[model samples]
Target: MRIYLDNAATTPLNREVFLAMEPYFFENFGNPSSAHHHGRGAKVAIAQARGIIADLLNASPDNIVFTSGGSEADNTAILSGIRSNGIKLAITSAFEHHAVLHTLQALEKNGEIRIVYLQHDAQGNLSLPHLEKLLSTNERAFVSVMHGNNEIGNLNDIEAIAQVCKRYQAVFHSDTVQSMGQYRYDTRRLNADFLVGSAHKFHGPKGIGFLYRNAGQALYPLIYGGAQEQKQRAGTENVTGIVGLAKALEISYRNQEVTRQHLLRLKERLIFKLRDRIADVDFNGNSANTGQSLNSVLSVSVPDPNTGISLISYLDQHQISVSGGSACNSHSGAASHVLSALDTPFGRATVRFSFSRYNTAEEIDYAVEKLAKCYAKPGVSAYAEGLLL
Candidate 1:
């Protein structure tokens, strides 16, 4: 069936978004940096796209700064925000994407800042009191928490978290890459200083995304020298990608409710089948909770951890693709930071099966059948319940 269940890593580009970008790539190809007619046209197109994105979040076009993708946007937000605001301490969770974690780590390594991790329960819920304590004692702190956990699909209460951050006057930056298109965001009430989005995370083209900086926030330019991005980001803009992103985001918002409801059904079906077909099967974090977890993600824990790679390969051989962690971090064969933070059962394999609007019930059935077959293979009885690692 060749089913793709890894939308969290990146989604296939939407046809409408592709068509929207075609004109910009050829007949309308012009450097937005130039001051000619063609350049002016491209500039206007970019401005229109920016306005659409800003409108989606109830933000101003002036607050949107386009970037390569979520990673770049996260990097720019963290470094620039800290430098410009004299933020010396940061609050984050152990399960945060490395985009935010690594940046904070580097800064802390160089004595640029101090980091405190928020307390989280086994189900990946944060302790609000812990956040309140950390925020209360820290001055000019940078808080980097994602809207949803990429590995485990636990959705955070950004609004509640934002309230605490506001009380402490902390600069809050959320990596909204995973939740941008799937959920609605109203910057008018989000109470955040910065939010980031990546087009590829939705159904838009790769290599383009944006950072939403509140009007009053001061962020230094991570990239040096260029009048582009209103002097915020350097280098020429990616006009085509920017257009596709805008179009894709528009489509996502338009179809968000229906798509979300449909994918939620697929997830529920997969969960039911996983339990029915496999022995001692379990899920990580809030992935099994439709109301709390992301509607598109399901992180399954099988009995055998040593066969993690084999299972993925076996599924690939059957033309069904899934993941063990974020595409960026899974190849290292190390446990996912998110799962590790939740203290997932020792030696149990974790397979993340994420979905998008394109997936179907038939594909979900086939994936479950293949997964059960993979675990039932001969001579691996050590995976039996009593022998669990």
Candidate 2:
């Protein structure tokens, strides 16, 4: 079986979620906006799913607005939060997901708002003091920071950052796409104005996600021409996907502790195996620091840039799958913006192996074994000799 270690990109849909979504596909398929019985049934299903999600998040049902996925939710939060609030200044980190960075950059280009990127240390940890300093000087700025780094697995102290934003009266939005299913977030206590989740990231169906806009926060619709999402978003809801997302999130929260423990074991095993088997292997960002990183992700850096470039394809040949960093950057082969922001060494190759509850210790060992072979000295392995055809 192929060792699938790219859960950060997406996860296999859970059987339970699939089953919960089955009826919605055909049996109950109807436009949620319709006024007939079929429409009411579909609308009720959406409401129940919304309630399940909101309750799980300890948030009010009205605060949750469903979108196509995390990208859409992120776009809605940044654009609406900034525009509706009339915020002219913004702060974000250099390594935020493109959804946030690019959107803000577009606004900056249009001269709608000026943005300041918060600096970070060599470890990829954002400087909260600098964030506070910027917020203090700016006039009611919008701040977008993520709870977890999708590429490097650095977990930011968003709660503390939220407090700082509160002190400066700045609107804070955190892209929690990577952190959502794995961690418990009580929106009532999070102190942020906006947060995002993508169903596909946590074993739910793709094409669905939710945006949590705290009570009293003003955000205009990202989509127009319909009353869906209480008019916060417009379109016919994806009933099947919505049902699956709710089911998937429920399963994730129910098994979160068990899943976390299992993933931690797998991650630690891989980290130990990689360090012991490779000569010049290291890690990027805070990925290797369990206390400060996502438990499911480990970003390994090999000394040889050539190996870094070829290791993934070599592993693929051996029935192992991994990534250089974010799947969004996998095709480009460009150095990850996250790693670049940290000034990672120029000659090293970085591989990100993300874990899930489905992963096993054997798969971890197998992946590392093949990984070490890829690093073999020049004549010892074909890949090491730059001989792969």
Candidate 3:
């Protein structure tokens, strides 16, 4: 049986989500921007989906803007939030998803703002003191931080971070793509100016995501043409995808507690089994603790960099699907900047095993068992160890 544990990358579409979206594919197909009976049906579906999501996050429907995916949502939140406020500086953590990091970098490259990277601890925590220093030392600042590190699964204290931003009077944005389904978020309680999410991250269809822009934040559009998303995102809305997204969010939240417990146990099982089966095994960030990190993700650093094929490739050969890093950087031909920035041993191989609600304890065992065989191969572990010294 194939064991797929890369939910951090993307999840399989829930059957319920598909059924919710099925009618929009052909029967009620219409462009939301058009003004006709067909178009009215599509528009209502999109509005209902947006309202459902807004209710879940405790935000007004007008505050949520649909985007192509997390990248666009993040870019919209960061760039627009920065420029809208005439911000001169941007601050972010070293472990943010490229969607946030790269957007900050591009803005810096264009001389729009100076970028400050907050200090990150070995446990994958961002230093609030460093953030305070940067904020106090700078002008109006735009800060972007992710709720969870995609690679290491470190959960940042967003509420604390939001408080700091409020104290500094800085604009704050968080990429909640990884944590939205796993944790509960109340925009009223958390005062972040912007929050972003991708539907695919939570078993919804891909190519659909949302950016929650705080109700009084006057932000401009990234895509401008016709009036859609309140003229904030100018493109025909993905009606089917939006409906799927709402249904997926509903299903995830319905079982969030039960799924959380199940995934946590699976993570702990892998942690102990890896230590028992492999020498010098390590878990990145605070992912070893379910309470501290994302319960679904465990960044496993092993001693083997098997020749001929990668550790991920070896696991794939054994019908276990995993990833070396974020799927976004899968084809970037670059090492994980998150791990590298943390001064990780250059020789070790890191595999991100992100679980879903569907993953079972038996599947976890099978992955670890297959991993043992991969390490048993000639020159795998020894090679990784020899280079460590």
Candidate 4:
């Protein structure tokens, strides 16, 4: 039985999304910028897709700007928000993905942006008091925090944070890539200046995502070229990818409750099975406060350090796909910054099993069974000790 438990990394493209994108690749291959019939048809499709995305986020189509993916969307928001507003201080958490972390680091090194790192509590929630203190010190700042952490699946109090930003008159941006399809976000209610999401994370095709910029907030374009994306972003659009994203978003929104409940059930089942069958296993994220998190991701750590990598390998060998950390940082063999920020034991064995609507209870059972066997292997404990030594 093959089980895919890495939906947080990327989900398989839904058939509906694929079908929606089919005609764009061959039948309607006109640039949206063209005024001809073919161009007009493509433009209509693009507009419709934008409308669909807008409806999903409860925003006007004019507020959405498509990009290559979440990384580009993040870069655009961070660079543009700071540059346009001339805000020297950027407040973000140390747990952010490399996309945000590295971007802020580069800007700081260049003396283009000053950054303040927000502290995370033991549960991975942002420390509001710390954030308020930082904001009080620097009145002119842009705060960027993620909606849901990709590794641990910890959800931040974005609404509260937005209120803090409002009090401080700072621009607030959120990387909602992980929570876009999983959670309900009404842009009007969230009150964030900028939000970013990637298509691939929501069972859509790769190479496309969008940044929702609230009206009246200007951002400098990272990619300068032909006027595309209403001058806020440039370069030719990914027609097929955009269509796929819209279809995916439509499905997600239409079936949000059903999918959310299904994923939560699977997550609970998996956690129960792990706890009932395995020893020395601890859940890493705020499982008790799941209402604030994406119920699909379950980050767990084994007390035995050596078993971490071996367990991942064993799961792979058993055709049960999981993640040691974010796929972007998996190759580096580094401990997760998210976990580290929460003061989770570093250099310990950890695995994140993220679910999707398509996952089933049977698959969870099989994964737990395989994990139990792997953890019980002879010398596995010794191997774990060696790593610490």
Candidate 5:
């Protein structure tokens, strides 16, 4: 039996979401921009979907601008939110996803703005006091902070961060891609200038997401051409994907409590079993802290730094799929920047096992059994230790 514990990378398409999107792919298909009967129907579907999503987040439909995915939404929020406001300074943490981190780096490379990286502890908790200090010290700045760490599963206190930014009168943007469907977000109460969501992260269709631009943000278009997305994003609307996204988010909210309990149980079970079965097993960041981190994600560390990739390969061979870090950087063949930034110990190998509603207790037990066996093998642990000596 193949067990997939990589929900953080992307989830399988939800059945209900697929059904909602089916009509758009066939009989009801039409370009939403057109004015004929066929086009009007498609346009209605898109608008309804937008309304559903907006209602769920307590955001205005006009504020939700569709994008290709989280990366695009992040880029849009960072570049447009910065340039359109005439801001020249930014603040973020090293734990941010590449989407936000790389975008700020590029801006700095072009001599467009200065970036102030907020201090973080080894457990990946960012300093909010430091954030306040930075904001007070700098001019009006664009602040990009993620709602959750994709690799370490650290949940940043974005609400607190948003409050600080508001006090400083700075623009705040959060990459909520990981925590979108998992957590409840009322944009009005949160008072963030921008927030982003990706459908694939929440069992919706891939290649579809949205940017929540607060009213009167005056953000310009990242893509230019058509009048789609209320002249903010310029491309033909992704009607099918939009329908899927709305349906998926609706289902997520309707069943949010049950899903939360299920995921938390699975995460706790995996943590307990791994600790009981493996010697010196540890968790990175606040992932082990149920109260602070994402219940869907857990980053496990074993006492063998050299075995990060090797252990992932072993698990794959045993029909258990997991990841050493973010799937986005898996092919880079370099150490995880998040782990590196935290100065993760040299003798520990890390693996991120993310859960979904589909994962079962039996699968958790099976994965732990395989991991225990891998460590039990002669020279598997000893060999790595020998190399360190």
Candidate 6:
């Protein structure tokens, strides 16, 4: 009875995706770069996958470039866009994941780019006025913002941000890995110059992701090798992974509306149960009034001075899976930057529970009951403190 509620970190691979990739592993294994029939078969699979992904994003197939994963896609967008466009500054929010933050920081330290961190409101909403001020101050720069936050589940107003970027004539990029399969995405409406996503975030295989480079924008290559991905990313393609990605995206898109409705219901149920059962538990993202949060993720903070890691361990022992923060940095033992941005006083107790289509309401109820019991135990608090210290 192990319940998995950490879909934001990575989803369980779908059976359909795994089945689609089986043949490519042995029977049809071929390097897409080679010239024989086996190679042609792999090339055709890659092309079909690219087309499917392009259709999902509402962009032409030519606009998409395959990468190793989301991190590589982020690096290609920020570092390559800055290098190619000669933009010396990058504007991003304080709540960005480390993939974007670390890349920007490294560039800043190398004296190649100036990084400006935008402040957010207490509800995790970006300040449009502050964004305008920064953009106006730096007329030409590269901007990277995520479509939906990985930890707190707050979705940014990409349309408003894009309008500001248009006014300033700056390059805009978004990390769409968390939002892509969960919501409907239209590149034209987003009006972003660069976008990134990973397959593993949406029930696809790992080690594969894509970057959407708007037409007419050129990005410098991160790796140099034989020309592939239109010479933008040069490496041998991961044929099986790419095939699995396409199948996953296709199934996700076909079921998007149904999945969204199911997740929204689960979110409502979880929120209600937590409020009824837990004391002094506060949500860290936008309230229900703002209409800006994603239904797939729900973050809660307990007021007790207990470490989330301890709660995570208790949940694990009870056969429940959840996360304290972004899985990418869970081991670091540092405060979540997203919670800090929201000015949450109980940031140390924050725990994120994200859902997917496979999640059930029974599991949610069990998790809430277990959490309430854990919080009421005085010994649990002491144990949590010991581990933190």
Top TM-score model = 2
Clashes (backbone N, CA, C under 3 Å), per candidate, total: 0, 0, 0, 1, 0, 0
Tens digit of lDDT per residue, candidate 5, span 1-389? Answer: 89999999999999989998998999889999999998999999999999999999899999888899999999999998889999999999998999999999999999999999989888988899899888887789899999988898999989999999999999999999999999999998999989999999999999999999999687667789999988889999999999999999999999899999999999999999998888778899998999999999999998663554477887898899999999998878888999999898896789899988899999999999877765664436533554322
Off by more than 4 A, model 5: 305-309, 377-389
Look at candidate 5 and give me any clashing residue pairs. none
Q: Could you tell me how far off, in angstroms, the CA of residue 353 lies in candidate 3 after the best superposition?
A: 0.5
Task: Give TM-scores for every candidate, taking all chains together and pairing residue i with residue i.
Answer: 0.95, 0.97, 0.95, 0.94, 0.96, 0.94
Give the per-residue lDDT of model 3 (tens digit) for 266-335. Answer: 9999999998888778888787987889998999988755454688877887788999988888877798
- Write down the RMSD of all candidates, one decimal each: 3.0, 1.7, 3.0, 3.0, 2.7, 2.9
Residue 204 lDDT, candidate 1, scale 0-100: 97
lDDT of each: 0.88, 0.89, 0.87, 0.85, 0.90, 0.85
Residue 276's lDDT within candidate 1 is 89
- In the range 193-247, model 6's lDDT, one tens digit per residue, is 9988899999999999889989968878899988998888888999999899889
RMSD of 5: 2.7
User: Which model scores highest in lDDT?
Assistant: 5
**Which residue pairs collide in model 2, if any?**
none
Q: Which residue runs of candidate 1 sit more than 4 Å off their true CA positions?
A: 305-309, 377-389
Error (Å) of candidate 6 at residue 354 is 0.5
Candidate 2 runs further than 4 Å off = 305-309, 378-389
Residues 232-287, model 1: lDDT tens digits = 89999999999999999999999999999999999999999999878778999998
